[model samples]
Target: MKGRSVILGQINGLEAAALMVDGQLEDLLIDSSGFAPLPPGAICRAKLGRQMKGQGGVFVDLPEGQTGFLREGKGLRPGDTVICQVAGGAEPGKALPVSLRVLFKSRYAIVTPGAPGLNISRRIRDEETRDGLQALADMVMEGSDMGLILRSACEGTEDGEIVEDIAAMRDLAEAVMADLDGAPELLVDAPTPHEEAWREWAEPAPDEVIEGDFATHGVLDAIEALASPRVDLPGSGYMMIEPTRALVAVDVNTGNDTSPAAALKANIIAARELPRQLRLRGLGGQITIDFAPMPKRDRQALEQQLRAAIKGETETSLAGWTPLGNFEMQRKRDRVARAMLIGGTE
Candidate 1:
């Protein structure tokens, strides 16, 4: 219950999936139902709708009445049509958007049609590896208009494979563009959460495993796990997460342990799990964590650990501990919650 978990389910002809960590469902996955599948990274034709006054982005009407926003209008008007890709899911409470900037991703590389340049993943730290990958990317994109971002997985891959990957993506881009006039619908679906998680991490942690009886489980089972905000810790503590209009509140309690050491232990556990919980639930806006009270030095250590735990998140920030020893954090929500995605939000 303290590592990763994967689940796939279907209900009412809608297929859904999820990824969980430490018994908390973190990422939600859903398949497109009608018209055509509008998966991320698939390019399609879209017509511009009315632009929001004072807002930089413009809304567009996607097939099937779903609304998508373009952060930059690129001079497109209400009636003008343009090609766009399903860039990503919408932020919590916002409609999904498409991007004029299209990217095709392989295991080792990300090929961009709009922005042509050589880039490397920031996660790759070794200078020599970065240089090698950059050089390889540059070589592959030598005369092509497409840009390439070399992922960490490309570090040890041969030049031939990398080149072939880039070329394959370029070909896919051409095919998508070519079919735009006749179909003008979604081209392909992005990898599901399960696929993305496995591909990026190579493998889940040793303890990670698929949950539920796959043969009998329904989508509701997965949805329920993701919708709830309460999670119990390994030994004798539990966390309750409640979201208010202004902020998300998380309270940690030492359920059965009363010793001084027990308090510290439970607090540390809560600190480690809190960030994962935030990510799993996709709760955003302001966040406040209330843990069992402890000394200043211990609290400081816990804060440092929490900071280290959430370092990978670009949109999440941790403010220093408050006077009352609580922690405050802010995370930008950019994906719909599972409950809302399934029309089960209350």
Candidate 2:
């Protein structure tokens, strides 16, 4: 397999990074300057602000006017201050203050307080693998109150590494708890998206890292191609992606190759490429994919393969096809729209 490349650029004056695999953009990671710098996995002290009626989550007011979402905290009243960890980041007008869950993310595991037990990644379906990780967790987490979630990255991690990671998180948790008396304080900042991306994929080793600036406009222009409505597939066919005020419509065209076999191949390739486009563009919300007419069996098979490719994506889902033969889907809206990012809008 060809190694990936990392491209860095400026989108709306915020630093951004894009990971490209085999000449195609895999994901575009961007950081905006509008929000306070809170790195993921960092615990912080926050106070409950006014409860927004009809909202599923409560607003947590941190120091310096920073806000957070207490998605699952119970018995919280307005003006009540508590400690919260930065679970996710803030987007322009959406996902602000970041979703503040009390979960601490480590390299090999997630330490969640009050849930005292060990849980393995559901992707590790093999009973033997799950049991092995459970044994390892039990050995290292002796007498610890926090529960551990063994991440997929811990599949083959050494015993010492797991031990060290848990130890570091424990110490960090202890320090945060020690200073809980201070209200509206930031105990820790979350890791930047670029840092997390580098730590995860840089070791597989990228061929090059491109930085985007006024001097590197060519790179940004190339990256912007991913946001285009029409894209040609590798061997044959093409895809037209149209976004409206409601849902995103993706129409697949087999082009000159009309044979059933050729169409199937093209649809499969398009199915694989579509998710990459969504990630690179940060396009989310309801999505409709129209495949070139294929047999029902082949369409079902294609859906399976597509779902497997996007399995871990919490926001995106293949909701099956419509009566009119189009595939219906939904992806949670997360980042700023692609047009805004490409145009460098403020």
- Candidate topping lDDT: 2
Cα-based lDDT for every prediction:
0.67, 0.70
* Candidate 2 residue-wise lDDT, 15-94, digit = tens: 77777677545776666334445544556788787666677778887665667777755677787767776654444444
Model 1, range 317-341, lDDT digits (tens) per residue? 8886788878888876544443445
All models, RMSD in angstroms: 5.5, 4.9
After TM-score superposition, the amount by which residue 8's alpha carbon in candidate 1 deviates from its true location, in angstroms, is 7.6
Q: Native-vs-model 2 lDDT?
A: 0.70
Model 2 per-residue lDDT at 188 = 71
Which stretches of model 2 miss by more than 4 angstroms?
A: 4-23, 34-44, 49-55, 59-75, 82-100, 119-136, 151-161, 177-185, 202-222, 242-247, 256-266, 292-299, 322-325, 332-346
